[model samples]
Target: MAGGDPHALLAAAADQMGKPPEGTPRRPRVGVDLGTASCVLVVLDSSDEGDCPVWVESAGSGALQDGVVVDFARAVATVRALRDRAVDALGTELSTAATAYPPCIPVADARACTYVCETAGFEDVTLVDEVTAAQRTLEITDGVVVDVGGGSTGVGVFRDGRLERLDDRPGGGHHLDLVLAGALGVETGEAERFKRERPTDALPILTPGLHRIAESIRAMTRGTDADLPLHLAGGALMIPRAGDVLAQYLQRTVVTHPHALLITPLGIARSAP
Candidate 1:
């Protein structure tokens, strides 16, 4: 059995923060995140303390189309492109890479994630579930960890250090953009920019959208809400007032991270063998 430090990998991937010094290893571990909006690749200089993410790179990709590999050749080429760029950044060849899939995906589709890495020329591949990967970074013992991606929100509730509930509901950043677009009569991209830049002012306007997400969380945590806290680990809800809004909606404590988007991808790297 083998395990790598998902936490340290995440920390270092985000500029080597909170990691032990790099150590000698056979080779650096590479990770690729096939996201809906972008495809990201990360390299970790693995050690006993954990693999330190030495480099991170991403490219805009519409090929995956909401976490599913709709266009196989496009997805593979995207992965390869990101892989080559990351290898160049780290000055090493990426022979082995780890990738992740969203929760509840079928085996065949999950295998596609590995195939993407394999097609990218990695001899070794590791596959991790997106929610479990996020936990590697959050280390949530007893509570819910919600990952709000552009198209869906995946929730995992843990009780006494074990996951008790898991589910996914579609409503996230893109949904918020839709709400903003309708209200302001702006394009989705413009609304996305507005929501990101002026989130403080956009909070009240986006309340229903946030509540929709909160309600989804409530639905996911119905059985476990007795005393469990809610820990948010995703990019879509990174807006400043999101946690506060969710806390008020759920009538429970909500935890937010400094850089939520990197949590799961880094966690996936940590899950490498």
Candidate 2:
């Protein structure tokens, strides 16, 4: 198991993006995240200390919507390209992988993620809900795990290292992009680029969208432990004050990990067999 402080694990994973670590990698595990905004592939090498990430890559290909495979061929192509690049960089063949989906989606839709990985050349594919995968990385024994992706927000409640509740709602970074586009009178694509390049300028415009996501979290986690801090995962709320807005709106403690975007992708890799 990758045992350590969750933030440290995330930072280590962030450090490994596109930069292979020293020495021969061992017990390589791969995770594929077919996000609405992009498809991310992560490969981790297992050791006595923990799982250290060796390779990380993302494609700007938008083939998924709300955690469902909307364009299977494009998703497959994107994953295959990531796999090829990782293979070339690591000098090893990755045969198995783990991927995730939103909790509210139908089972059939979740299976489509597996099919994409299989078609992308993985011999074995493991399927897990996006929230659970994030927990696998955060190891939140008694906190709420909120994964806000480009298309949806998935929530997981944990107690004593066990998941007590799991749910998701449709609203995330893509929704924020739409809001920003409307405010700036620009295309959604342009809004997305602006949000990424100039988040300081974009934060004020996206506050309502962030609040909507916070509302989704509040709704999904109504009955869970209210005292436990909300731990945010995924890339949607990585904007500077986004977490602050969530914390303020919800009136609950919010733990925003560094390299927030890679949390779920790294968790998916840890879930790989």
Candidate 1 structure quality by residue, lDDT tens digits, 1-273: 023544444455666533332433356766677887777776666666545566666677766655678888888899888777665555667787778887776788889989988987888998987788788777788888888887778888887778887887778787888999999999988998998899898888899999999898888778675567777886788889789998998899988877687887777766776
lDDT of each: 0.76, 0.89
Please give the lDDT score for candidate 2: 0.89
lDDT of 2 by residue, 16-42 (tens): 777764645679999999999888999
CA RMSD for every model? 3.7, 1.5
Q: In candidate 1, which residue pairs clash?
A: 6-270
Candidate 2 TM-score, C-alpha based = 0.96
Residue 31 in model 1: shift from native, Å?
2.1
**Top of the candidates by TM-score:** 2
